[model samples]
Target: MATSMRATINIARGMDGAIAEILLGAVKGQNLAAERLLALSAAEAPLDSNSGGTLIASGTVVPAAAVGDDSLVTYDTPYAARWHEDQELVDNLGRHYMGDSNFQNGRKSHYLVDPARENKAELIAIVAAGVKRG
Candidate 1:
């Protein structure tokens, strides 16, 4: 005669629960990282002495709600998009215009985009830090 043994294993949580946890962690991590990215991009943003530095001050981060959702990093000025696109007019409009602040150096055009691209790796790392590979 031959005998067989059977065993059962219980996961700490169900698949759906595990997935939800991971998504929560990722969302939190993304939000945490978004702050730093926003700050960096803002610092890199072209400083417009005109309009009281509106472009530099408009850097914003709209965080992701879910794993598949994209977190928006944007500026909230009317000319933000045009300025970011490196339009010549945006450049000439600055430089201590009337009530605006003095011209600022060390800022660059395409400021937000460039920093985001360069720091992509760091962003991913920050996101990854919240999840564990199974």
Candidate 2:
């Protein structure tokens, strides 16, 4: 048997702990506070965290959440004031999340949208894997 889980990984060269918390919380059906999502950067400029950032999550389980049978979890690169300006950053985030050891085992993954057909060049979710909390 398999259970659906919804997740979004935000990678921008920093911890993004608060943002992770928001995503985690959202999965658990919690309403996140405004401060939790405070933008660290505008469109032209990006920000890095002062502390080393590791992936953080909110909700029922730390890294995994129970999703509805048909829920779709989408991962769109962070939208900035100017979309095209951060192409490299977005690309790197997608590659790292897909290739990173943190997510390698257990779950199956796929690109939500093909970058080849889309100028957005960000990852969109086509499918996700069923995973157990470690």
Q: Best TM-score goes to which candidate?
A: 1
Q: Candidate 2, overall lDDT?
A: 0.26
Separately for all candidates shown, the number of backbone clashes (residues 3 or more apart, or on different chains) is 0, 6
Off by over 4 Å in 2: 1-15, 30-134
lDDT for residue 92 in candidate 2, whole number 0-100: 41
Against the correct fold, how does model 2 do in TM-score? 0.15
Q: State the RMSD for candidate 1.
A: 5.9
Candidate 1 — what's its lDDT?
A: 0.73
lDDT per residue (tens digit) for residues 30-109 in model 2? 11111111111111122223321111111111222333322332223343212223223335446532232222222111
Which whole-number lDDT from 0 to 100 does residue 112 have in model 1? 80
